[model samples]
Target: MAMDEIIPPPEVDLPRETEDSERIIPSPDVEYLPRQTEDTERKLPSPEVDYLSRQNEDILEQKEEHGKTTELERKEKQLKEERHGEEHERPHEELGQGTKLETQCEEHKRLERQCEELERQRRKLERQGEELKRMKTITIVYEQFRQWIEDKASNSSSGVSFIEFNPSEVDDSVPKDQNHCLGRGGYGIVYKAKLRNETVAMKILNESSRQGEREFKQEIAILKRIRHQNLITLRGACSEKFALMYELLPNGTLEDRLINEKQRESFSWEERVRVATSICTALVFLHNAKPNPIAHGDLKPGNILFDDENICKLSDFGISRLLQQTNDTGTPNHITEVPKGSGPYMDPEFKNTGKLTPQSDVFALGIILLQLVTGQSATGLRKHIVDKLEGKKLEKMDTRKQKMILEKLQILDAQLKLDDTSIQDAVKMVSLGLRCSNSERKRRPSLEIEVWPEIESMNKSECLYGSDEVD
Candidate 1:
């Protein structure tokens, strides 16, 4: 402690970069480390020194803790940024993929719908093509028939007249207009036409088979010669197309009237009796022809038609055969290999023997009679009638028809002054029908001898009950 003597500064301990005698130098702008004065070091008490040392240690520990906390906060912020980026990118990718999938689905559905539509159109076109092909074939067939007819007409010199018909006149379009096609059958197709101030049904044969061509020629020949009130009248014919024009029957066929319940309601008992009588009359005329008796090969309800006046007319003589007459007797001989008649109404005897006679026609008439009695199909009626004849109950006959007929008869008895004779005549007629339809050809009754008498008796009863009542 000499007065005015200079003392050197004490050395300050500072952090070093390495332990190998290397002290860290601070930058010129940085403050130097703090150092205690000699007088303060000498005067300071032990407790005070200890307190300052503890304070320094506390400051150092506080600085270290603050640095560690800052580092932790920075790391946490970096992790959050990375997570946020990843979440944002994943949503964008998922959204893009979902959009692509939805677009693909929409496109697929649209294509499927278009494919289905195309398939439907293809099927419709195929059907149309088939129909066109059929028309073309028919047109070609008509042209062939026309040529044959022209040649025959030129050579024969027989007073037979036939009009030339253009095949184009009849087409698919002909069937679409008003009063179009009237009907079609196995032999020919019929169309409704308005011809020269008259409505006529034009029947054109397909002539696809040999049988059909033969029938076309035979029908024309048969219709030209025969003329009767019950027989259908021929208007004209086109030999070229094998088409024949006939008087139009607006009331349709007898089969339609009998089979259709709605039409049957309008057909009264008197009408049925009249129809039967007319058919019998026609058969009688055919069976007893001038030179040779013409056997109508097909006799069924379908062959019978009704005019505008509801008059019954027999038609379709395609399979009619002109029987040969034996020189010894004027009796008609059987025709062998005759074409079979319509099903149900055809005679089984004729089918077995291949012989067509007028008796075969009677068998069909018997079935028609059964149809008038019972509102059931004329087909398979023979079995039902035989069942009834065997003393068994009519299992197949409609019970509803019995009630309807009985009720109708009761009404007729009251209104038309009919008696038990009418009922007896009906029952007798049914009995006659059964005998006429007998499976044994010999057992079956003749249309002229046995059937005519019974039908005339029924007709008499109808007349007695007042024939004017039906008209």
Candidate 2:
């Protein structure tokens, strides 16, 4: 192609230049050309330079877009790594918390087991202590018995004779019949027998247990030393057979008379009062015995006896206790691990504390008084009388108030056929009975100080005025 065909022609017309406008001057080597006619063959400029310039601008724009895309991809990768790391650590924290909870539960269970073990140990210790106390009591009683037997053997004139008679001779002398059996007790059976050419009551032990032998020895020891009108007299003993001989009382036990309907009718109110007085006299004698005061641990109606004169004689020295002086102050401490007595006649304090005192016998006597006045069984008799007198209050009341209450009270047995004067005496006796049978030991009247005086005064008043006097 021609050079002219490759270049375009310039136009002749140009704009006038102003003062501030830029001026253009033609080069010395350049030539100006006229405009070509339309009919002439015109050459168009080549498009290669403009195309190359547009391609370079497009490449720069593409490079800038690629840099922006790379920055956004880098930020997204960092966020994903941070989220993955957090997810991995979350499980470890949850596992640690779960392990801590399991440890706490195990610790709580261990503490509960330890507490149960401690409670069991405490109960076992209490049982051991009770057993120790029982063993100590047995040892003491055995030593005292050994000393007594030795003294009796060494000194013939010890004021109390313990004769060891032949068992076959005593058995042959006594008759074996139900009629001859005066009474049957837990320890033995009593029979009217001829011993040493004298009519006597013989108690043959049913069993030769240690308890029976001890009771046999204790009875001989006590009865030989004591002699009273209202107490049974021991004649002799058979050691091999565990038999005791006593002066026969033909009237039998007070329990039989109290229970039999015909005998209860014949048992008059004055006789009942006299029986009470006789028992009180016996208790006073036994309680005031010189060496050591004695307490009839079991003083129920079954243990009380009557002679041909119908005088009340206390019996059954099996469970009786001698209040041995443990200290110089004479405060007797006769404590037994196991208490022996009738349930209805047992003193409340003695049952709880297992300590026997003369007041315990007085408690039984109070129950007997209640039985004499009401002719009722000893079971629940005290509560029945107290509830009637106090109207369910049962608290302590003044003497005047109690007397007034007793005057209006109507709890006496109708079978007794008590006259108005006898009823007054019964009321006074009931007052004294309630005072003696108080549940609290301190509230009970002293046998020597208060009980004996009041009973003796009643006996004297009855003898002087014949139940007609109120005071």
Please name the candidate that would achieve the greatest lDDT relative to the true structure: 2
- Runs of candidate 2 exceeding 4 Å displacement: 1-163, 208-210, 326-330, 391-410, 460-471
Compared to the true structure, candidate 2 yields what TM-score?
A: 0.59
Model 1 over residues 1-471: C-alpha lDDT tens digits?
A: 332453554566755656755555764323321223454456445787799989999999999998898888898999999999999999999999999999999999999999999999999998787655434433332343345457756877422333444655533224556447777787767888755555678887766533566777787777777666678878677666777778787888888977777787777777888899878777777776667788887888888999888889899888888877777654465656755678888888888878777778888888888777665687677676565456522223454553345454331122222255555555656677787888877788756545765676677433322133221
Candidate No. with top TM-score:
2
* lDDT per residue (tens digit) for residues 68-142 in model 2: 888778878887888888788878888899899889889989998998999889889876765554343333323
For model 1, the local distance difference test gives 0.69
For all predictions, the C-alpha RMSD in Å is: 25.1, 16.1
Backbone clash pairs for candidate 2 read none
Candidate 1, pairs of clashing residues: 146-240
TM-score of each model, in listed order: 0.56, 0.59
